[model samples]
Target: MSKLERNEILLLFDVDGTLTFPRTVIKPEFEEFFYSKVQPRATIGIVGGSDLEKMFEQLNGKKILEKFDFIFPENGLVQIEAGKEVGKQSIQEHLGEKTLQRFINYVLKYLSELELPIKRGTFLEFRNGMMNICPIGRQCTREERNMFAEYDNQHGVRKAMINALTREFADVDLTYSIGGQISFDVFPHGWDKTYCLRHIEKFHNFEEIHFFGDKTEPGGNDYEIFVDPRTIEHKVETPDDTRRILTELLGL
Candidate 1:
């Protein structure tokens, strides 16, 4: 880790399980530390994989968002400014529409024709310029959703899916990310926290930057952003840790 100066940080935090409690939003100490201690000293931005609506809901809407000057929402696809969306990047940019459509249609066809004891979630979720696909069920309970993740390990479905697609489509690249229980965040081969931070960092030149998140483990969602050389990682375990990390960094 880098024992860097606190004020010279451009802090970025992942919301689910990091700032907000996992599965639900109930983190008071983090909220207090964010709004009271950290928000004033350094520029803060929430870099999460959640959709726009869910992002606002988790953050208590525009009021909380207004605290930060900018947001890297939708897993770094959509850039929001002052509560208004300003830009977006779609994973499909790497794939032609016709080609992507063909693959998506084929997946849907196979899913409909074949019967699996374990069900799947959303196959395609299109929003803005981006298109997301969850090989399992969408909007299902956490238990129902978890089946998909476990399926990846037991049946090797997730890995197999990526391998099959990559083999079939040599010109296209397909990758999978564990987003929550029932989600596979398919983005460009290089769409990750580093890339996301590159985009966010260009706009704001901060003196210090820190990252607070949960899924930093390998193959977990926070892998990309957590290990940034300029970032201070605050692990999500107890609210006290979040507060302590922030206070210690800020010298509060």
Candidate 2:
């Protein structure tokens, strides 16, 4: 494909699988490409459901994190700079504390009801604007993660969770989607990742913006932006795929 025309473009990425392996550091070559190629050509930002701490785990270091012009953590609920928080918005603030707490309680109960074969610690994680619910828990080791992943593939546990929550919270006006491979992200209606567009437009100017993500299916976290008309979107499969896409997109 011909290189995208050079211009003031905003290249936004999803961190977990798009930028690096889930819960892992960026590949060395991918890191080199970001610094030597991508960053110099276009404004870059990371808009992800993971909190800043987890995002840093994937980036590997503060120096690597600093390369992006913006980092929209917790699904664009906050923007950070130089290890300082510059802006923040909380979905629980809008949803009401009582309601959010109730939702959490319901999720916990639902997971217990499933009575799956394996369970790890820290099943649900609350972030600024969203919460990640994992049936198998977030603290699973790589081997355990793979085991649950196989079971989930066959049982569609994540999808079942999504459906259960959607129906249970139908009257509450919320959104739910499978995030990455193991969990579902639940937030107030309209708080999907596309929420970043409003903040980005308000703070910066660009002729065109591009988004790359691994999960762009109908019920995936990146689906909202993938379908949005305001931004051009690219779908990638893995970190290596991301590197190849960026290399070609940036003409590296």
Candidate 3:
């Protein structure tokens, strides 16, 4: 397809579990297929909860900026278009230091008191747009991450923590989202994946916006954009699922 023809549609994807496995690099075969076949048919973009650096580690490193037409890291709090950063937002700027500290302190206390199967360091990760709170810590090994995912599924640890946070910070205009296998994100209202649409709309008009993500259930980080009226949503379970849908939809 010609560039003009392809630009009429946007294929927006979530990083983890959509384009690649959770917190892992994209497979070489899939990467080659995506760049060689899939990317040629439409305008490609990525909206991920992780910071740009992490997105880089998983999706072709610094070259990612050149790969995707739109790169929305930190849920578009940090926006890059055509290899140039166009916009950025900061959680510290949105929520004053006093409130931010209070929230952090409260989360630390809650995590400290709560009992988990195991605990490691870096429980509270402050990002450009939000704070990622991991009860088992982000430094856990791959096996441990999978273990906690199973444990949280059966025990509802992350859900319960989100519930507690929702009640405690009810008046703070915040949104707590559960994503990936390990942690939930805390950000101001409207900072979810849908935030990227604002930037996309400002620059181009597309006939269709198709979003593919795994965590589209309620309170999942992808929920807002998945259900948003503007885009057609595809709920995928794995990178293979995403590739299948893309091939079927675009006839690749």
Candidate 4:
């Protein structure tokens, strides 16, 4: 970890488990800290796998977002500043729409073959810059989400799906990670969370950049960013853990 100096550090945060529980709103205490400590002391940015719409929901709408210096949505495929879109990169730009469509169809077909025991709704979610596929479907309730999540951990269902996808689409350039309770973030190679740094650097400078994320372990979405030399990464288990760490970092 690098020495902390006010105004000399950029703090990047992952949304799901770092700022809030997956698909949940940010806790009020942490939101207060963000407004009090982080926003005033450091360059604030959020790098997340979810789309801007989801980010807004997790953050409890646009009020919290306006406090940040920058925002990276869809794993940094889109960048925003002051509530306005600044820049964007699309997965279709790297892989043609036909190719992406093919991959989506292929995964859907694979899911059909599995015939998993769950009420399904919209197995494949296309986010323009990335895809999040949930075998149990995206429309699941919180309890149903938990049910599938438990089953997935026990069955290695996502791992099997990933293995099949790699073998069948060997010619395609793609990257994916198990995101949240029951979904996969599928995008072009190197479009992981680390992709945001290059864009954020063009606007701000920091001697030491720190990142907070839950999935910093191997084969996880935050792994690439955690391992990057440019960031001093901390693996947090939940949003409260993130808040606790931040409190220490800020010496509060």
After superposing candidate 1, which stretches have Cα over 4 Å from the reference? 1-7, 92-94, 113-121, 146-157, 237-241
TM-score of 2: 0.93
Q: Roughly what TM-score does model 4 have, to 2 decimal places? A: 0.95
Q: On lDDT, who's better, 3 or 4?
A: 3
Model 1 lDDT tens row, 58-170? 77776855787668776677887667777777656667788778878866775575444566556678654344556665766677656656766687665555556566666
How much is 37 displaced in model 1, in angstroms?
2.5
CA lDDT, candidate 1, residue 160: 59
**What is the per-residue lDDT of model 4 for residues 62-167, given as tens digits with 9 covering 90 to 100?**
8746788778898898988767888888777778879977987898788888866686688887776788888888898999999888998999888889888889
List the RMSD of every prediction in angstroms.
Answer: 3.4, 2.1, 1.7, 1.6
Q: Is candidate 3 or candidate 4 better by TM-score?
A: 3
lDDT of each: 0.67, 0.82, 0.92, 0.84
lDDT of 2 by residue, 13-94 (tens): 9998898887678888888877788887887889998888878778976764567777888778887644567788887788
**TM-score rank, highest first?**
3, 4, 2, 1
TM-score for model 3? 0.97
* Residue 247 alpha-carbon offset, candidate 4, angstroms: 1.4
- Enumerate residue pairs that collide in model 3: none
For model 3, residues 54-95, the per-residue Cα lDDT tens digits are 998998789887888999998888999999998999999999
List TM-score per model, in order. Answer: 0.79, 0.93, 0.97, 0.95
Stretches > 4 Å off in candidate 2: 1-7, 81-84
Quality of model 4 by C-alpha lDDT: 0.84
